[model samples]
Target chain A: MRRFFAAGLTLLLVCAATALAVHAADGTVYGKGVTLTESVPIADLMADPEAWVGKRVRVEGLVVDVCKKRGCWMELAGGENQPAVRIKVEDGVIVFPLEARGHEAVAEGVFTRIVLDDGLGEAHSHEGHDAESCRKETRPGVIYLIRGTGAIIR
Target chain B: MAGSAPRANHRVRRWLRVIHRDAGYLAVGLTLVYAVSGVAVNHVADWNPSRVIERVERPLDLGDVRTDDALVDAVGAALGIDTPPARTFRATADRLLLFWDGMTVEADLARGMATIETVRDRPVLRQVNLLHLNEPKGWWTLVADLYAVVLAFLALSGMFLLRGRQGLAGRGKWLVGAGLALPLIALLLLRGGP
Candidate 1:
């Protein structure tokens, strides 16, 4: 009886330690030292037309929304046209603050490029469809898309 | 029957130990993969740690929207496609749209400018991310669900694998407590305000 208890206890500790190690490593690699360029204070990256266009700079803000599926994209607090950088979270990296939309966050990635259709520029154009579908057909060099690895949300 | 019982009990215990240990080892790597991917994906608004950079350039003229058909033909020619364009439209007088490869292309019809953008799917990470998200689908979802249950089992069984002062009752318990507390504290801080 005592031996069984001991074995169980050992297994538990190992598992816990493994979990901690996994979390620690992920946090260090993905959340420690990332920066972005853009000082806009809105939630939608498309809202701010000038601040984000044709520029590469780092900005700090909050995460306003996240995708439930494969975490394809996230929204920030910059506004409609000149919002904070909309992050395309890498497929396998795990981020913190899973559920809170209004949480303060700091992201570091390139302000590359994005191009939206002129017709869908109006706010009400995408009423029933998902937001991803509303994005204008993505063009190559016409828009800036940020790509980064590290983020911290307080 | 009584004489055979001890041997059967011994055999069962041995098999249990073997299954438990081997399963634990097999699960360790996958656990890390899922756990890391899960946390990163949860906070999608935060940032992407593993992003690949890509660049594309196409030479074309954007001065005339009426010549857009020629532009598409040129693109199709460049891509070595002989089939008629599945569909074509103008995103703008300056921008021409082309559809291919389950993706869309937008180009400047007048300026000879073309931009190609596609979501970069990280190699192993993409599949791991799918598993972590638990998308309700075919066998993958079922496997993920099973992995979740196994993780719970591993966590519970792990507590017993150690012994004495370093075991669950001592240092083990402390470590577990700390692990649980860290997330809880973060949650509390995030909630803020009464």
Candidate 2:
């Protein structure tokens, strides 16, 4: 009876050790990069895009939208009238459903440029007007688009 | 009666041990895959997972480019359009319209120039993302359902792995209680319950 009890105890210890190892490995593999706080503003990101490229950085904000089909893009609000940055899901990253919108999040990933247009000409033409009219209408709402890659949506 | 009872008890314990060990090992990798992907998917508005690698501008000489077949062909050639343009229009006085890959582009007529931008999805994570949704259909959905069932089993079996004071009756009970309470507390604090 004593021998049986000792053997059972050993088996339980082994299982516990295995579980701990698995959990530790996951944290090491996926938890790469730095945390984001309110002090680190969008202006700071724009100031040094090259250095931050391909490096994971976290940002917190309120979600505005999610893709109805595949979760391709999500809009995050910074402040009122401030152009919302549309966060794109990295190729393999899976985000949750639309219910997550309006929820605050801290996401980590590399910041990259997603310029929708190289010039203002596309914006001007879409409104069915000349350069002056396009400039008058589109200029006010112009937004510079930047996307993050390998993002973990928290 | 006692002899027969011992044999049956031994058989039951043996089967339980085998099932617990095998299932635990099989679930390790899959558990992490789904957990990480699920968290990322849940918070979509926070970030883009894909990266835009490069953007280039190529100049073309359309030379009085008009809103006709010839102009479209010239524009297509200059922009390196792999397939026929999905749509084209007169975007403005100096620009012509073109659309591809869920985006619109405008080319300058006189300069024969257009900007070409390409975005490539991030590797590994992109495929994992697809698995998270089981979007491919047929076999994938079946696999996802199986995974869900296994997860439920894991939760249940895990409770019985230990016994006695340090096991489910004492410390184990406390651990399980804490696990349940954490999620309940978060739901109450964050969403105010339903």
Query: Per-residue lDDT of B1-194 in model 1, one digit per residue for the tens?
Result: 88799788567656656767977876887788788787766755454433332436666543333466777887666655577655555444565556443334556655666655433556776656655664323344566777778888777767666567887888999999999999999997886321
Query: Could you give candidate 2's per-residue lDDT for residues B1-194 as a string of tens digits?
Result: 87999698567757766787878777787788787777776754454433222446788777664646777788777666767665555434566655454333456665667765444565766566666766333345666788788888878877766657876788998889999999999987895311
Model 2: CAPRI class: incorrect
> How much does candidate 1 score in TM-score?
0.45
Best by DockQ: 1
Model 2: CA > 4 A from native: A1-154, B1-13, B50-63, B76-117, B192-194
Instruction: Give the best candidate by TM-score.
Output: 2
DockQ of each model vs. true complex:
0.03, 0.02
Which ranges in model 1 have alpha carbons more than 4 Å from their true place? A1-154, B1-19, B39-59, B62-68, B74-87, B91-94, B110-112, B118-120, B191-194
lDDT score, candidate 1: 0.54
Tens digits of per-residue lDDT for model 2 on A18-58? 75565355221112322554324444555566655655556
For model 2 chain B, give the 10-residue run with minimal summed lDDT.
B45-54
